[model samples]
Target chain A: MPHIDRRIGFMGSGQMAEALAKGLINRGVVTPNQICCTDPVQARKDLFRSFGASSYDTTLEVVHNADVLFVAVKPQYVGAVLTEARPHLTPRHVVVSIAAGITVDMLLDAAGPEAHVVRVMPNTPCLVGETAAAMCVGGKATPEDAELVSTLFSAVGRIYQLDEKLLAAVTGLSGSGPAFVFLMIEALADGGVRAGLPRDVAQALAAQTVLGSAKMVLETGKHPGALKDMVTSPGGTTIAGVHELEMGGVRAAFMSAVVAATNRANELSRMG
Target chain B: MPHIDRRIGFMGSGQMAEALAKGLINRGVVTPNQICCTDPVQARKDLFRSFGASSYDTTLEVVHNADVLFVAVKPQYVGAVLTEARPHLTPRHVVVSIAAGITVDMLLDAAGPEAHVVRVMPNTPCLVGETAAAMCVGGKATPEDAELVSTLFSAVGRIYQLDEKLLAAVTGLSGSGPAFVFLMIEALADGGVRAGLPRDVAQALAAQTVLGSAKMVLETGKHPGALKDMVTSPGGTTIAGVHELEMGGVRAAFMSAVVAATNRANELSRMG
Candidate 1:
């Protein structure tokens, strides 16, 4: 990964945008002084300014100044913001959208044919420096443009290069998946409380278990099934617990959650 | 956290013993020669030896030489091993047991009243330097003794101090819980795959989401429900997906898994 020193700007200053800006500056990818963002909401603009970043009231100022401009607004606002900044966007500028259900073609249409557009679907884990984010290249996006976008998001988490068609699936899985895991951790903690452990300790242990197991999967590069088997010693407690998860249909539920979310994303984009 | 320089020894040189030896040596708590272990299997002994730890074929040698002695044998073998090493065990030695269902009281009974006994239930993620481990002090153990054990395990992962009565809950939640998480992550990956993402990419994203979300829960110290709400906007993909998870009984299933595993741990200890 190249060390990015370019000025990064955002068209919105929501939590997602702040997560990226804070992550970039914290990792020394870019300093706060190198970050500038635009937001109509005074409080949102003030929020970004708290990180030592410059804030603007209009989108064109951000588009004109920054080398990489992030379109981080709501899905419904992407077209309007892109159109407002269309005249200022240059071929050298990379416009990346973090808004869900916003298509690369729609962004390209609003920003003009020469502008480089990259679409991203990032989960809230970006705030914790462990986000799972995916990016898609637009019609005019160069390989360098894709690299730059990946590098920016990579500062916060793992980045996957994706096709526009597959971005909805990414939205459904990693995008909405954090909430599911949070719920599971919460429920696991509840079980611990019921079993006689203190609330705080159980939550801590449950969260750590999820964090560690996820890391084991990435670090070992072994199959998850193999790792699960490693812990399940024949007729042991782990196997017994696994039987409950299986019988409770956890696997099917998670599968359906992603599918349902993906269909919802597809519908939103279609409506847009 | 005091830096532990005491000589550490393992009575059983299995994967658990190797993990501790390697972690202690890696963290510079004790040098390779300062660590010693006894095991019947040559391969297991060789594994610890690779980390500069001395290998012995008898349990008495490990109990005699080290200031902190770890009894890492199987549950059925813990009593016999402790009984054989009882005469060699002194007041200065802190005898720790990592075997499941082997209570601190049982260890105290085998090793006699003078030795300090501590019991731990740690998940397999200790191998990745991010384990969830809990320790309980026996009748003869002092606060300093607990501190030493906590510092030792803390080198590889997070440690929680609890009563011996709560160890079964720890076993079910964090001990056997890693397997439950691996299954959930695999199931989440399966969901991602069903939603049209590639198998490897889907698995990677799913694992990262779990890892990141877990970090969020620990770092933010906020309620998991609040964190879930932070990601879920009105009519957004996350909320839509969360609804599916709610409909699918994910929380109930995870709660049942932990409860079942805890019950199993209680039963196993009773049978022992």
Candidate 2:
């Protein structure tokens, strides 16, 4: 894919906004000088400025200055931000929203049906060049618009295209899944501590184990169950531990967590 | 800091031994010519030889030819293998054992007390250049000997030095933790499937989520809880899913899995 050479801007200079901007800039996908943003918060604006990007005070100002505008505000504020910027958004602009629970229909509704809109649910791992982002095109979004947005996010990590309806499920799996993993790492470290290992070493080992195992799945293109079976010998320590994980219903809980979160995402959309 | 310059050999040409050898050669840290192994299995010997390394029928031939030898036999066969090769193992050779549940004392006792030995617990991710391995030096092993083994294994993945007693915990957490992580990914993928995503996309997202989250924990130098908080907005989707996870005692189950595996590792050692 080609680099996103057009000017880009963000409506909110928050964590997600900064992550996207930083990832794009660091990967040389979009130059820092080609990026700009607006935020009420001084700290966030200052952080944006540090990346060699200019800052504005209002969403309309950012939309006017850039060709590709990103609305990185919270879900509730997405409506107001996009609606306000809708007036300034020209046909040249592609508006991408990273707000949680905000749908493509919502973006199209808020920012005029004529506006090119993309709804994205990107996780925090963008800070580490490993984000798993999902994007959905709106009524007016062109193939070029979708490609531009996907290219922008891919600099941070992998990007998947899905139906807007599946965005909530994406939220549940990739967005919320990280927290579940963090909790698991914490528990694994605690388990190591219980087994007489020092806290730091245990934590390091736990985090790396997850990272490595995940890499095995992604790189090898093998089934997780097959990988798990390979690790579990006829009567080995991994199998013993696996037995406990199975008994504890770890799988069911994760499945339910996603279901509950997806349900909540649907509710938030309905509340809007 | 330097790569292992000596000829290395593996007693068992199994999956792990091949993973290490392949990782080292692929990384260009050690040439395939520097690695040799002996296994009764003809297929295993052919695979090892395909790497441009020599293979032998007897462990004694490998022990005599290589300066740094790895004993990759099963836990139960570690004593017999080492005892059989002990007489041929000259003072110039440093023996590294990756046999689970076999301690330094057992290696020292089985192979003469003067034999230089190091016990390592390495996981399957070594095949992916992201393995989390732990090594403990034996009484007769010198600092140089420890460095050689560590350098050799580091080519395949990261290695940490710890006391011998903690290897069992390492076995529980990292050694067995990959299997637990695979289960989590499977569950997380199932969650996505339940939410209406295609299986392949869901699995990719689940695995990448874990990988990206782990990278954030490792690279950001922030606590996982703090990182989780960074992603969780007030009244957001992530927190809702997290609540369900907490209610499910998912963390406790993972902790218990590690502890159960650690206890099993200790038990296996005791059984020996």
Candidate 3:
């Protein structure tokens, strides 16, 4: 379990911050009162207040109250928020950033050189408590800080610790990958409708099929190819479908998509 | 909960039958002693015995003992097994067949006209307790029989009651869909590997991304297209990846795969 007494704060009380707070409280990792946040939006602040956490209008108050501070603002606003909180940031604070394209160096520059920093890429599915997240610690971060971040993230979903260099690949795969899957599910439901199933039934089955198949891969510890083969009998419908996917170059399409996304992440990071 | 007092029996103790039995036992839908089975393979019978269920040598014995009789034999052997147990099957018996392409009429022909019958199409993910299943009640089946079958299947995963004409579409979407999604997960992982992620890390992340995205659609009760749009931002990595997928015709490929699979299912059903 994470340190329940630790005061966790968010620099921006956005949807992502709200998800993390919900996970922490729901999982009993921390008491609701142990969390605090700052957001300019009145409605967002009220949302945090509904979670039994204090919400403020200033970064300084969150920095003062929080032991672990999350820089949860938008990518463009990350620098400004961290810089505003830099003066009050101390060794007691471990600053974690969920902002896309924000590097550890940028965070350290804005948060002061001595501050501990961790950069994480989490997907939108965090709202459903099924996030796929990955994190890398900065030069100033201790092993304890990494552990704390890992514990907090595991509450919502699976989390991996990787090198900073691989964070772009993580962005391409788990981060942007959810959108790709959503497209696939929609397409599958469309196919079902095309095949004469009612739209609602088709959509429900399409999503459930994706969910179950993914569970097979994760739970069975079998190779996806092996699992596919297990279900594909000779002259069967699965094989027929697989043949169509291959003929249409589905694999190449997915490969190109992931690579393109990774390239875009690289471009954004460079521009940042 | 399913009727815990009702006895369930499998005519053939194959992997699917084992999965269903395990699900019923694990979910407290039924006690192990309420289950019985017969298999030609000694190992399979022993496996059922390990679950504290009775293992019989003859299908007649299972038919006599169980109120709910699962026609779990392979498609090729279903006729022979059902015919052998036909005399024992009474109005009390709800004969549920999970053999692909075997229609409710075929089950009625072999099990006797008076026997309540259901034709179900369930995928291999039943092994992981996340099965996607659909069923259509036969002419002799009562509403009570349909409810009982639904209760039994709900223990394993989601179940839908649909018209018999739509079973082929169900076979295409949920039945063959898992293999398609498995192939996608493998391709996604391969893409991650191409983009510089470790193989294990890439595979785990890819599978989790699929699972999380699917959960978002199911739990949020939102259209997958809407959810996809929610995550995409202007000039972002997700949109970049999605653009590549579109350019490569990923959606059309999926639609074609599901349609082709549905056509194959129709052909197989006709042949049967």
Candidate 4:
């Protein structure tokens, strides 16, 4: 495979597509004009245009023009979109699918036997330049093809490469982890509001607290239990909270949530 | 009263005291030697020496030498430490207590009738450049006293002023919130490990995902739920994880945890 200047296209102009485009452009990985997207919906097309990226009405145009095509449609529609766009794809074109629960095998089948395919699971933070994504290659995708896809994801945030089999677990963890965290922050903030703090003050406190504590774990590299012990004294308030969480089965609940999502992803793969 | 350069003392030689001392010295708010601390433990004295600050053998020496004293002792010994140091305190000195669950009333009473006091609850992230701290002033503290204490905390991280009644809730939320988040990240990383990703790779993804998503919430000012919906389509994998959380009562459990901590803080205040 020869190294070529990166030309990327989005088969769908949804939030994920726009976020990746925004991240790539902001990081100087690709220019606004160099990236192209197509969406049947007028609002989505207009939204993409506002970011100064080129937008098309049909998937054929994007597949015909770009070197790397990101199939960003929903998981259920991935088959239809890939089948429709496959004839325009050649061996030189690297196809990456961002639809969750859709496996690399299904994507490769839809894009034809000769097409190089990479499967990616990226979370919501990519829109704001803080995405955690995992990418894996299958079929005709060479090392060069994998590197190209990795570069695109890395421009937005951290990227990891794993066997395609574990991408669903990544889907369960990072891909859906943000929502679980958001809910946690909301519940904490609501506690503050109920305790008589003003809404904005409460929200800021709740959010910044989460932000700061997370940075602690990254910077210190200490065990979470040690840090928890630092904050908690014998018979102190924090221990009270921990006791409640334990009693309420918070940890088991989160674990089960991730497992459930992973099982669902596997089911989707089998269905496809 | 004339404005004088205040000499501040930290009574414990630990991460929190060192972090605050460094922050104050970095900002020229106080000098290394101008701040005094005491830890009966030799290891803690060495840690203070590493920061180029003076460490004392007894709490009385620290209280006698400094105009503003931070009682950074652990929660269990706050009473004993304050009792030992109280006789040396003068009306000119201010006592700032960072021991969580130790009330301002208890601190003032322990330090005697003339001592001006304040209570603060801060999380461990203060070691970095970010911390969420909530503070409340004692009956004797003036606005100027409050401002000075606020300035000291600001050097370490953000500081918020609230009624003393709400301090326990702040303790429940941010002061303990980090541990809850750390558990979530650990569980998520464990899921990745179970799915065949390397431990280090899984840890990095889990940690970075948290960092980025938190940045999004802080920067965007959008409702977390709204941001969540933006990432999730009608039947996507994110919604699948969300469904499990809903099923397992994640929101309710976390909310109850905060309330439990608040109640415990209130109980601690009455423990004498």
Candidate 5:
């Protein structure tokens, strides 16, 4: 468990920050009163205030108030925000950044060389409490800082501690992968509609099937191929569908999507 | 909630029957003592016995003992099992069949015309308590029987009441869809590994990404395309990946898989 008394802060009160704050409070990891945030937009600050958390207009106030600060600004704004709070950076502060293309070295450069930093790549599903997130610690970060970040992230979804080099793959697989799945679900519903089901019924069933299938994979800890075999009987409809998917080259399509996304992430990081 | 005291029985103690029984007991819909099963295999009967449910060797005994009977035999054996229990079935009995490709007309024919029947198409995720099921009632079934069936199936996962004509589509979408999704998840993991992630980490993220994305679709009541747009930024990783999926004909592939599966299901039903 993370420290209940720790004051958590967000340098930017964006959607991702709001999601983390909501998850942390909902999971009883911290109280609403223990959360603070900074955002330039008045409406965004009001959104945090509506949730019973304190919100501010500048990064320095959040830095002064919080022990663990999340850098949740857009990638372009990350360096500016961290540098604004650099003077207040202390050994007590653990800075965690969720900016998409920003690396730990960049955060360390902006927040000062002695500052503790952790870089995380989280998907949009954090809003729905099922995020797949990965994190890696900077040189200045302690093991306790890594544990705290892991605990905080696990409240939203499953989190993995991995080498920083793997974060781009995480960005590809869990980050961009959601869009690929959304497309697949829509296509599946279209198939059902074509097969005589009502549109709404098809959509609901399509989404639920994806949810259930993913749960089976996670809970069984069985190789997905083994799980697929469990559902496919000899000469059954499942095998027929699987055959069509194979003939259509669905596997290669998904593989290519991930590879493209990872390459793009690498490109974006280099540009950042 | 369905009647707590109503006795439930499985006409055949197969994997599907066990899953429903476990779901019912776990959800507090029924007690183990309220459940009964009949199986020719001593091992299967013993498995039910081990779970504190009464098991018998004869369908007649189960029919006489239980008010709500699940016709869980294989498609080929449904006729023989229902015929054997025909004399024992009464007006109080509600026959719910999960036999794939076996129609209500066939069940009614085997159990006698006055019999109440409901046909359901449930996927393999029922074993994990995340089933996507659809059911339709026969002419002899009452509204109360339909409600009871809905309640029972909902305990395992989401259930829809639809016309019998659309069941082939349901079978294609939710029934056979899991295997397709499994193959996609595996491919996504492979892509992640190709991008430099460890295999275990890649697999976990891939599955969680699917689960979370599906949850966003179900929980937000938003169109999947809109959700995809939420994650996609201009010239970003998600759109890059989506572009690859589009170029690879991923959507058409999924749509064709469902259509192919539906056609196979229709063929199997005709043969049955």
Candidate 6:
């Protein structure tokens, strides 16, 4: 894909905004002069400036200065941010919201009917160009707008397009999934540490194992079970590990976690 | 570190052996001529040939032709294979064994007193240049021999040097940890499918999330909890998902899973 060089604006200067901005700059997808950010908090503006991007004091100013508007404020403040920036949202602009729990319909409703809005749920790893992000097109978003959003996200990591209804599950699995994985890695490292490996060595081993295994799934396109069976000899150590995971009901716990997050997303959508 | 090419000899042509050989060749760390694998099974020998490596008819021929010998046979037959190869083994040759539940002492005894033997536990992802492998030096192996083993393993992924006692835990965590992670990814992908995302898309998302998150911990050098906190905004979608994970005891279940694997590894070590 060609470099996008989009004139992008963010309504918040939080981690998500910074991550996106950094991804854009790192990938040469967007120039510093082409990006503008605003946050009510002065500290956030300072953070934005550290990326060599322009910063404004208010959302309206950011929206007025860019062709693409990213509504990256907290979900609780989305309504106010949208209302404040509404005047600056012109017909040529595409509005994308990274606000968690904010639905496409809500984004459309707040940003105006004609706004080409899209809702994206991106995980924390976006800061490192390895994020798993899912996008849902708003009622008014064109295929072009969706493609543009995807191009921007591709600079960070893989991007998925799904119906708005599935965004919550994305929020649960990928957005929140990192924490679960981190905890697992930490626990595994602790197990290694307990087994008498140095802390750094154990941590690195545990982490590299996770990274390599995930890559196996993606690169091979094999069923996880089939790929797993390949690793596990009959009565080997892998089967022993699988036996423990089965005994502990790991599958059920993760299932429940995703379901709970999806249900909460629905609740937040309804509240809006 | 200088690029050290290891002349690896595999005493079996099974999946794990072939995977390791392919891993070495794929990374250009070992040339096709440098690797000699032996298997009585004709089909397995053919499979090894297709991977651009030479195959021999007997363990003696392979052990005689190589600097490092890997005993990759099933644990039940490892003693027989080691006995067959012991006559060709010399003090200059480093014998490494990947047979699960086999001990360094067992391997050393089979290869004889003068032989430099090492015990390694490697996962299946090694086939893709991302294996997590743990190695423990035996009584006769020198630091130079250990460094050579590390060099060979670096082609696949991260290699750790640990006391022989911890090989079982390494076996449990990484040797079997891939299956545990595969199950988690599969379960999460199913949850995404349940929430209306297509199967392939959901699988990709779940797999990539696991991969990216693991990379974050390895590269960022921060505590997993710190990275988790960075991603999660208060009461946001991630926090909502995290709450569900906590409620479902995801952390506890995962911890127990690792503990179960580690304990099982310890048990297997005792059996050996």
Best by DockQ: 5
lDDT of 1 at A52: 97
Tell how far residue A155 is off in model 5, in angstroms: 0.6
- Give all TM-scores, in the order shown: 0.95, 0.92, 0.97, 0.79, 0.97, 0.87
lDDT of 6 by residue, A139-192 (tens): 678898999999999988899998777787788788778887887788777766
Query: When superposed on Cα atoms, how far off is each prediction in RMSD?
Result: 2.0, 2.4, 1.4, 5.0, 1.4, 3.3
Error of 4 at A173 (Å): 2.4
How good is model 1 by TM-score? Answer: 0.95
lDDT of 2 by residue, A46-94 (tens): 9989879999887777887899988888778988998888777788999
What is the Å distance of residue A150 in model 3 from its true position?
Answer: 0.9
Among incorrect, acceptable, medium and high, the docking class of model 6 is medium
Interface RMSD of each: 0.7, 0.8, 0.7, 1.7, 0.7, 1.9
Cα error of candidate 2 at position A110, Å: 2.9
DockQ for candidate 3, C-alpha atoms: 0.86
Q: The CA-based lDDT of model 4 is what?
A: 0.80
C-alpha lDDT of residue A225 in model 1: 91
> Per-residue lDDT tens digits of candidate 6, residues B142-231?
999999888887877878888877776777667777887888889888777776678898889999999999999988889887888876
Poorest lDDT segment (10 consecutive residues) of candidate 3 chain A: A1-10
lDDT of 3: 0.92
Q: State residue B124's C-alpha deviation in candidate 6, in Å.
A: 2.0
Q: What is the DockQ of candidate 4?
A: 0.48
DockQ of 5: 0.87
Please give the CA lDDT of all the candidate structures.
0.88, 0.88, 0.92, 0.80, 0.92, 0.80
> What 10-residue stretch in candidate 5 chain B is worst by lDDT?
B1-10
TM-score of B-chain for each predicted structure, in order: 0.96, 0.96, 0.98, 0.88, 0.97, 0.94
What residue pairs are clashing in model 2?
none
